[model samples]
Target: NAGVTQTPKFRVLKTGQSMTLLCAQDMNHEYMYWYRQDPGMGLRLIHYSVGEGTTAKGEVPDGYNVSRLKKQNFLLGLESAAPSQTSVYFCASSYVIGAGRNTGELFFGEGSRLTVL
Candidate 1:
């Protein structure tokens, strides 16, 4: 089973176009997250879902939306793609811990590259 996979390995978007990047996982994880990594910037959380049918805004959620309609899929939507939104996006997942130490074990998928101009 594929741990995690993202569609459209690369994409170019016009200033105001829209698109949805799909992320799928087979691990049955309880937590899923979307992050954007840019030059000189560490990974910043965009949106996250603790489980199916639940969603939450993250650090940089102004220009993004997310949905977890299915247990195996998490979708990130850009209503109006902008140059500021042009960054490498990564989808990650992990198991839920009641309370534990920091293992720092985050599973990341091959990122999706997007260019908005």
Candidate 2:
């Protein structure tokens, strides 16, 4: 069902270059998230949205921006790329299975790898 899909599976950029990663989900989930994975750091949240037309900063929101204008899509933009931003980015979406509670279950995209030179 194409639970979650991330575009540009891999990319390389020079300092100051710009790019955008696209995430699309068909599950119509209420929550969407962007996370970056680095060695030994697991996954660190960069941004998230509770629903369409709403977004919020996450654990590591710097150097990145996100937009969720549509319920099925989430876009992550790097205005000016940097070496520190080189990592594997993942997009996830989930729904609340219970009343006002999240089970911490997420359906993730394949991942987009960004390399900054």
Candidate 3:
């Protein structure tokens, strides 16, 4: 089974264009996260979901939105793409420990690279 899958591995968008990045996981993980990586700076969390139909803002959630409609799927959306938003997006999932804490390691997708002009 595919552990995690991200769609549109690569994408280019104009300044105001919008796009959605899809992430799917075969593993029944209760915690899923979206992160963006840029040069110099390390990965930054964008948005995350603790379970199906439950989502929360992460460290850097501005200009983006996330949804977890199904247990195995999480989607990230960019309403208006910007050059500042250009980065490699990674999707990860991990099992939740007791009290909803995540102690296990995360499984990450290959990553989706986005470039906005």
Candidate 4:
């Protein structure tokens, strides 16, 4: 089974265009996250969900929105794409260890690279 999967794999957009990225997991994880990676900045959280139907903004959520309509899927949307929003996005999921705690080992999907001009 695919532990985690990300769609489009790659995309290119012009400024102001909009698109959505899809992520799916089959491990029944209760926690899911969206992150973006830049050249030297590592990865930055864009949004996350603690459980199905619950979503919250992360560190770099400014240019993105996310939804967790079902336990096994997460969706990230860009309302209006911008050049600065271009980056390699990653989707991850893991089990919640204890209340507010995590094992720190996340299952990651193959990255989705998006570029905006």
Candidate 5:
């Protein structure tokens, strides 16, 4: 089973354009997250969902919005694309965090490359 999948592996958007990146998982995980990786930088959290119908903002939530309507899908949207948003976006999922579980590990998709000009 695919852990997580993100559509449009590559995208190029001009300034002011808008787009949504779709993430889906078959594992039925209750925790899902959206992150962006820039060159020589660690993953920065954008948005996360602890469960269906519940969403939260993370470290860097500007210019982005998220929704988790179904248990298996998390959508990230950019209202207006900006050159500063050009980075590799990654979709990740994990089980609930506990002291002894593998909650510290994140299952990441190949990543969606976005170029804003």
Candidate 6:
């Protein structure tokens, strides 16, 4: 049971609503990422953090905010939800396996499905 876990697996919100998705990992991984999966668009990175207390924007970060205040927790927040934001959100974590390089094998949570009306 020592892997990534996401809270509120399913949620529905109206336009302009706000919510936060919590991701916790007991594996002590150094890198954590938030991604959204949409029909035919595949998985797009929203935000990521390389270590505790640090975060950075990813490919699709316009409407999302992320925080990595603790080593084991990463939070993704939507300040204003929109219908276009409806998608399956995934959290992943991994650690570097070799010298300055990641193994590219991420442990993903069961995902959070969000629907905006």
Please tell me which predicted candidate would have the highest lDDT against the true structure: 2
**Residue 80 lDDT (model 6):** 98
Q: Write the per-residue lDDT of candidate 1 for residues 1-117, one digit (tens) a residue.
A: 889899978999999999999999999887889999999999999999989999999999998999999988999999999999999999998886667643346788999999999
Query: Candidate 5 — which residues are off by over 4 angstroms?
Result: 97-102
Query: What global local distance difference test value does model 5 have?
Result: 0.94
Clash number for each model: 0, 0, 0, 0, 0, 0
TM-scores across all candidates?
0.93, 0.97, 0.95, 0.95, 0.94, 0.96
In model 6, where is the ten-residue run with the lowest total lDDT?
A: 95-104
- Candidate 6, superposed: residue stretches over 4 Å from native: none
lDDT of 5 by residue, 1-117 (tens): 978999989999999999999999998788999999998989999999989999999999999999999999999999999999999999999887565655767788889999999
Residue-level lDDT for 23 in candidate 4: 99
**Clashing residue pairs in candidate 6 (N, C-alpha, C atoms within 3 angstroms):** none
For each candidate in the order shown, give its overall lDDT on alpha carbons.
0.92, 0.97, 0.95, 0.95, 0.94, 0.95
Which model, 1 or 2, shows the larger TM-score? 2
Please estimate how well model 3 matches the true structure, expressed as its whole-model Cα lDDT: 0.95
Candidate 1 local accuracy as lDDT? 0.92
Best by TM-score: 2
Cand. 6 TM to true fold: 0.96
For model 4, what is the error of residue 88's alpha carbon versus the real structure, in angstroms, after optimal superposition? 0.1
Clashing pairs in 4: none
Tens-digit lDDT track of model 4 for 4-96: 999989999999999999999999999999999999999999999989999998998998989999999999999999999989999999997
Candidate 3, residues 1-113, lDDT tens digits: the string is: 98999999999999999999999999999989999999899989999998999999999999999999998999999999999999999999999777746575989999999
